[model samples]
Target: MNGKVLLVEDDASIATVIRSALEDEGFAVDRCESIAARDRALASDRYDVMLTDVMLADGDGIASIDSVRAACPQMPLIVLSAQNTLDTAVRASDTGAFEYFPKPFDLDDLVRAVVQAGGSGDKRGEEAEAGDGLPLVGRSQAMQAVYRMITRVLRNDLTVLVLGESGTGKELVAEAIHQLGHRKSGPFVAVNAAAIPADLIESELFGHEKGAFTGAIAQAIGKFEQANGGTLFLDEIGDMPIEAQTRLLRALQSGRIRRVGGRQEIAVDVRIIAATNRDLKPMIAAGQFREDLYYRLNVVPIVLPPLRDRVEDIEALAKHFLGLAAREGLPERRIDRPALALLEQQPWRGNVRELQNAVYRLALMARDDVIDAGTVTAVLGDPAEAVMRGRDDALGAALAAWLGDNAPAHGTLYHRAVSAFERPLFEYALGQTGGNQLRAAKLLGINRNTLRKRLGELQINADSFARAE
Candidate 1:
């Protein structure tokens, strides 16, 4: 808080606000309007941190950072930009800025970042070569945080854990890290742990030697070896078997692995990027997922926001998918603004993957080059009905699975099913309302007394859903 700060921004209003906030926090602040002034200040005096806006009156702030870094290489740099795109985030990262705050950012968060930056030394590292075909796309504020997190890990091999609901493009995040990172030249290997049988997951990851098991006709290389000098993306990591988790943990810890039955430990030079749709914390508490392994993999957790949360990005994402479909031999199509509006209103329960599929379907089946709301409805059906259909399908499948697995006594089946359905429904309401009984009851469209009675019968601790501030 007592560190000297050099603030470079062209707009007097913004500069004043930032300078005043820093001064209030006990920081000595110097104001500058352009990159030239920023450079002059750097030469005249040493500042603990430099907070600069991207666009200046004379030249681009981020582009001129090389000169600033050369003059004061040890000083931590924090970038402020109104250009809140993924490209901008990557550029700030390339300059080795301590943090990048997109314009319209929280003032308190910026002050807090400055406080953290003051105590830190230089974070400048080798600049990551920017790639044109960036896999992930979204300029929304929610996506800015994700883009920043992605850039932070591009120059390093820190183990990353991508968490999101299914179809939220978790693999795309893994791909972006690999493609934009230093490992771009090497192979990018991905394995879905959930798709693979639990028995074969270990062999799939660490390989197996000849005669290791009944099916081992010859020695085979595993994903770790295949992705040597690059990245190994373990998708659906939450579904991996307990035994495989142990082996994975050992390999991650030691930087080496052994064949299923081999005596020699083969060294691997691979970056581990794991992703899962499941909440690992709950799994850890339930003793299903290993706590130690969770900690090892959660070093740099990147939580991808669900589609419902980033509705603003729906238009861009839909257009992106349409372009992809066109390149893949499907008929090109453009969605009109009205159609896009309809899309943004729908609760995309299945997230981006589902949207992509819907787009591809529209591209293939649209009557005209321009997709209208009627065309969308014709191809995808009414948005509300689609959501209900998805939920009904999922519920039917879940009920089928439950009945197949647990065939209760004839008289108790109805009671058991009602309890099963009501418990999760009430829990979801409570969770959404943060355990406020009145709010939860309103959310569920039920009486508070009825909710209380049901909670008592279900033995659910409503207080557990209330998050600590």
Candidate 2:
């Protein structure tokens, strides 16, 4: 509180309000309206912290920070911006700013950040270049919280637990952290706990040795080893078996893993980013999931808002999906205002993924270049029906159809049904990965040899799915 702060903002009212707040906290404030004045002031006096607006009278405040750093390299910098997009937030973080406050931010939070920055000394580092075409979309206030939380963890390797309903883009948040953080140069390995069979979960994570178990033909690396020096994204962590959870907690605690049937413990350097659609509290109470594991992963929790809660973002999200669909070889189509309104009114129980699918359907089925309300209704079905047609209903109908069409003998039904579902599943994975066995195995949370064996047994010619390099 007994430090000097430089304020570089052009708005008189905002400047006055901030000045009053800072002075009331027992700090001396120096005000400047332009980058030129800021540089001049920094050249003359040393301050503990500098609070600057991104847009200034003379130039972009964030862009002009080189001169400020040259003038007072030790001062902690705080960025305030009205442009509340993810790009802007990342730009501010790329500057190594102590904190970034979007427009209409809480005044008390700003003051506390200033106080912390003033006492923390220098917070700058080698600025990481922000990547282009970031995956996350939407700029609603609800999303602002998500963006800010994402920026806070880029500079560190803290464990992040992303919680949200299915299809809420939890993995996207994890990907953003890895792509934008210091680990961008390293490999990003992902595994879904719920997708793998319970017996294989540990081997899928910590690897296995040759002859470790039945059909363990050769030594294989695990997700941990593959993600060394980078990030390991554990999706659906809540569904991991209790025994695997204990091993996972141990690995997190010791930073080491013992391969199955191996005597020596191998050390791994990887950042963990876990996400789940299930609430762990109930599972913990029931002793289904370990309480200790929950706390270890919950070091930094980021809760994603469901799409139904953030209705304002539907239009932007819908348009984004439309663009993506067109780029992916779908017919190009734009939604009319009425169509967009219809989209916003539905309860997107499946969140962003459902909306993206709906948009793709609309793009493919629309007769006219411009999609209207009638087309939306026709292509996606009535809003009420769409809401009722959740994932369970679709799966149930598919199962019923399969059962009716192929009435296998009672004892053989399970095997036949599993093979029926897995054929298309394996094909889809191969198609998505351009027939790269290694990548498809990762996508499906199974071993590479297993995928190859399944493909051969199912008479799937993987070469047909291969893309021209």
Candidate 3:
């Protein structure tokens, strides 16, 4: 771990602090205030490790990293930068940097990375082939593909659409993209499309001018304005209102917006990433979703696998949750081999989120510190059987009854049955989302305007569903 260090940084204070910390660990430090000085130091000295900042006084550190690598092919290079974008992180990764640390980074992490860089040890997020910095937690091929896709989108601002079931961590993927992209230094604003009320979704996304509505007290910034120069993550985007979808599509195409009551158009620069659990094709066919908007958002689609598909990764995910539980002072705990095996065999209807909830519950409720099969069995109760039964008994019966009744019908009867089934389903979704047209639309995998039109056709009143108990 002890070796000679070359530090390339423009900031004098940061260099001195880093040098002092490295010196405390019995390593000789050669500090360079600029990339030019760095080249001289690298040529003259055979250092064990070299650290360079992305933004340097003379030239860009990232640009110089390639030359440094060529000169010192065997030497490990650590990149430090205040630029802190997904673009920087990915560039450093692509250049084969031993480590990439964003500015205001933890001093201890730097020391540990330095020691590891000087040595041949593998870090938590590193494998022989894949060298990601974030602890995404799964080592399965499913996750490897995910990592590759995420890394691909990190360098650019291409709109990304993350498709995954709930609790599969779609937002985390969005966050990773934002953190690794050129906009890393900018704000990352996230809004759940299904959580906002339909009436307010317009104003929420695009700020309203004062007196635009009865409640307009002052001019407020919307998600687009707030996320200027960064990324806007729209969770459950399939739920966005149809009317709002029109406005959003305009903004995405023109990169400009006009407030609710204001005439002045404001330009914005923001990356858009959207996620949804529901299938959207049927909604599009049903005239509840816009085909053009779907095409725009689906520019770069990444589908996250459900937990059941990658059973090999269950133990790692469970242990990660357990580790989190232990850190939160839930009394030290560990899952036994049998318990882990049992988890991998589960149906995992709720996917990773369900597993996390179950693991945390087991960690807290287990009689012994080491959780065994009995504890997992007792906690999960019936291995998601009840959930399957609930769905089969109700919906399965309904489907069976419809098929039996419609078997004699001729000439493509799917349309008739679908029409019969959709009315109640739409009503239920509207109720569940508390009549929030946007959320209900999202829940139905359609657009808000579509939901509103449907309501009028069916004469469904949403005001009573404003809140659900």
Candidate 4:
């Protein structure tokens, strides 16, 4: 059989787009527009693979997977959906789908999976072979630096502190560390400090006894316990509550944790991997974060440069994301030179995450064989016109507003707008500076003590900043 694929999608436009892409790749693409058509295709065809959307106009896509499996037991199936919840991804995996890509997936990932389907390390292959490294599609020097750090951390159990912008794949770096590290056998337990409610974070990190709180009906295991002997990825660690920070500091100091409602301390042997978009030194200086814990977690820091800083990787990354999207049944898509040039020109404030989103949007909306600059402009909305022309209809109005109103006619807009962007930068720089007030202030261009006052206002590193320089 010639790498046949069964694609079930309700949207004819999307299906047609996907078919063209796959056909170009030499796959005998079979499109089924509805559940009935899907059933008919399955009955008549023996496909090497199946790409199914999570929702069909006639019924549930998850339900259809079982039918596909019953029909083609050995076929590799990939589920494409907009749902991003862990439960949804887990359920798709549980149903025996080879992979579950959240909607807006890059097309490169899909193609890679197809290429690796019968080879070693395919998505559903054995645990030792199924490495979950970040789908960081690039070979640029910046990416090489990131890959080096990941490889280094994976060789052993080193406490890693990853610093990056919000959408720069900090969590992916942490997971890659786990997948590549000596402790790959253990579960990668991720806890987003900022996402958890302040009152519940402690209990979440350290399991509570049954009846510890109003909803505690059964004994619960905290993230520390779950990640025992594996990796504990604390995302947005800068946002961890002060009380929890104190507790976490003690836990890291002693390798033992006291459950929220229990008196006894349980020892855990977990490799800590923390990440944050914010700076920690300022938080430590302001006394919002514990100083002692900062040093403990800062053993090895991996800083991820934002997408704008590494513009060399745009074309490769965009094509990679587009390929993943197509395999997930969006539409077979290709970025023309003009579209790629426009992508390279954008100021990626949200970093790689934003670019992936834009490409996915373009793939869905673009109407022909190629995605040109017009399609990119339509989906990404022209930033220059949006910003410089003050066109409110432009999608990049915010960027335009910042550039036109604040940027002076001198150096680059980045240098001029650095102060306005100081919040995220200050938070990160201070953490990098280890909470020294005089040092943090000097780095940020304020007086040594003036930096201290701002840390207080932002509830950042007051103690670290207050330290003797």
TM-score of 3: 0.60
Q: For residues 82-175, could you state the per-residue lDDT of candidate 3 as single tens digits?
A: 6654455566666667777766778998999898888863222321122255545676656655765776676678999999999888998898
* Model 3: worst 10 consecutive residues (lDDT sum): 122-131
Deviating ranges (above 4 Å) for candidate 4: 1-134, 386-469
Question: What pairs collide in candidate 1?
Answer: none
- The lDDT for every candidate, in the order shown, is 0.91, 0.91, 0.82, 0.76
Error of 2 at 396 (Å): 15
TM-score of each: 0.83, 0.79, 0.60, 0.56
Candidate number with the higher TM-score (3 or 4): 3
Indicate whether candidate 2 or candidate 3 has the larger TM-score: 2
Q: Per-residue alpha-carbon lDDT of model 1 for 283-387, expressed as tens digits?
A: 999889999999999999999999999999999999999999999999988999999988886767889988999899989989899999998888777889877
Candidate 3: residue 262 Cα off by (Å): 1.6
Model 4: lowest-lDDT 10 consecutive positions: 120-129
lDDT of 2 by residue, 18-78 (tens): 9999999999999999999998899898899999999988989999899988878788999
Q: How do the residues 297-414 of candidate 4 rate in per-residue lDDT, one tens digit apiece?
A: 9899999989878887899889988888898889988888988988888877778998889888888999986999988888878867644444344536655776765556666766
Q: Rank the candidates by lDDT, best first.
A: 2, 1, 3, 4
* Root-mean-square deviation of Cα positions for candidate 4 versus the true structure, in angstroms: 18.6
RMSD of each: 6.7, 17.8, 18.9, 18.6
Give the clash count for each candidate.
Answer: 0, 0, 9, 41
